[model samples]
Target: MSQNKKQKGKFKQKLTDKYRLVVLNEDTFEERFSLKLSRLNVFVLGGFFSIVLMGLTFSVVAFTPIKNYIPGYSSTILKANAINATLKADSLKVQLAILENYTKALRPVLTGELAPEEIDSLVLQQERRIIDESRLNATKEDSLFREMVELSDRFPLVSNMESNVKLVFFAPVSGQISQEFDPSVKHYAVDILANIGAPVKAIADGTVIFSGWTTETGYVLILKHSNNFISVYKHNGNLLKEASDLVQSGEAIASVGSTGKLTTGPHLHFELWSDGYAVDPVKYIDFK
Candidate 1:
């Protein structure tokens, strides 16, 4: 027991022994600085500095952008960009779907596949879905205002005529009507006997919604005008306007010809529609 105690004391003394570290100027042989440190103090200071260095390194990696440079770490900016790209892709998909549905709905009309009444019903259904007429009740003040406006505008004959005429259609071709619009026989168009290659004009300002050939209509050109008006020029010899082309009233859009299988001779087979319902073009235009 005494020998063990003696060895422990010597070990303790060695750990507690002070050492002097001196810096000297080599040429002058003069002591510039001196520090006294024990073995235990040096070990503790070295361990403390090591621990502090490790803590600094951890802080830089955890809180700073340097973490992105390390493997297995994701960049915050890149993550945000990825999320934004995903959202844009979703939006594009929705837009493409809407466009596809719109094209599908119009295909029948453009191809003349649907009956006139069916087309009208489709338009009516779409209108009903868009507007709730039950919620459009006019108040007493609104009725009174409408009455006042009507009374004030009643006496101006020319102004009244102009106001009543929402759309003024120009004659598509100056020719004698070979066939008048007779919906009872499913003839919802007027066949105007014009010279072959006669210029056919647009009835009003519109966009050419369809300009293509069909088995029954041949070279057909359909225009979509304001106020939900649509005009179709069928059996055309040639189309001057392509689809999506903008045309003005009285502009030549096609040439009359008996191109379709249904025609007997060269003539302009023109159909007019208002709000998806067939309208007699003779009532609105003077073909002579």
Candidate 2:
């Protein structure tokens, strides 16, 4: 107990021991500044200055953009912006994939690499829309027939009418012409005999207006081009282009096959119309 008490007294004595700190002018030997402090005082002052410096550094980092450089520290606005940008990029990727699929479907048509016609008739049933009306009464039928006759006379099926506007055309297929446009028998199109799975291309850049099957013409595709021109493709094994899709000239739209009741074999029935009138496709395209 006496030794411990003596040690304690010595420690206290060291802490309370005062020292004078003085600054003097070098040449004049005049005192400029002086301070009276103990070792305990010096330690406390140094610790206080260190704490103040640390607090100042923390304030600058927390209140300024410098905090962004630190790990795991981010502003709310910056984080939200990054998230939004990421979502937008993901959406764009999805859209790009759809476009790629759309373009890929047309490549085989242009390249004539077609799959076999083993697809079921129901494969595209969901895209088909058929409308059939029952026959009217005799009196009503006569009236309708008379109206149709008058309209036909006014329009008078004309063949090989020259287009007033100059337009470039892309050949839809490379095949032998089996049939020619003969409007007298109401055959307003040409037929080209091709391989069973040959690709059928578009004659011009256009938006698909119709893509579906019909009893008379199976798997028909119709595109509405510029300058009031419309192109029709019928009796296809399958249609690659869908309605409302924008297609470029020479792009594949379908595969040739015998799909309609009127078809004799795998062939493409192509028709070109100008201003609601059927024109000879041979006049515009060279599908040899």
TM-score per model over all chains: 0.50, 0.43
* Candidate 2 stretches greater than 4 Å from native: 1-166
**Per-residue accuracy of model 2 over 170-243 as CA lDDT, tens digit each:** 98888899999876566889999999888899988999999999998889999999999899999999999899
How large an RMSD does model 2 have?
Answer: 19.6
Q: Write the per-residue lDDT of candidate 1 for residues 83-202, one digit (tens) a residue.
A: 999999999999999999999988988999988899888776764422233566899999999788878875767876885666679999998999998765778899999999889999
What TM-score should be assigned to candidate 1? 0.50
**Per-model tally of clashing residue pairs:** 0, 0
Please report, as a residue range, the 10-residue window in candidate 2 with the lowest summed lDDT.
Answer: 127-136
lDDT of 1: 0.89
RMSD of each: 14.5, 19.6
In model 2, state the lDDT of residue 242. 93
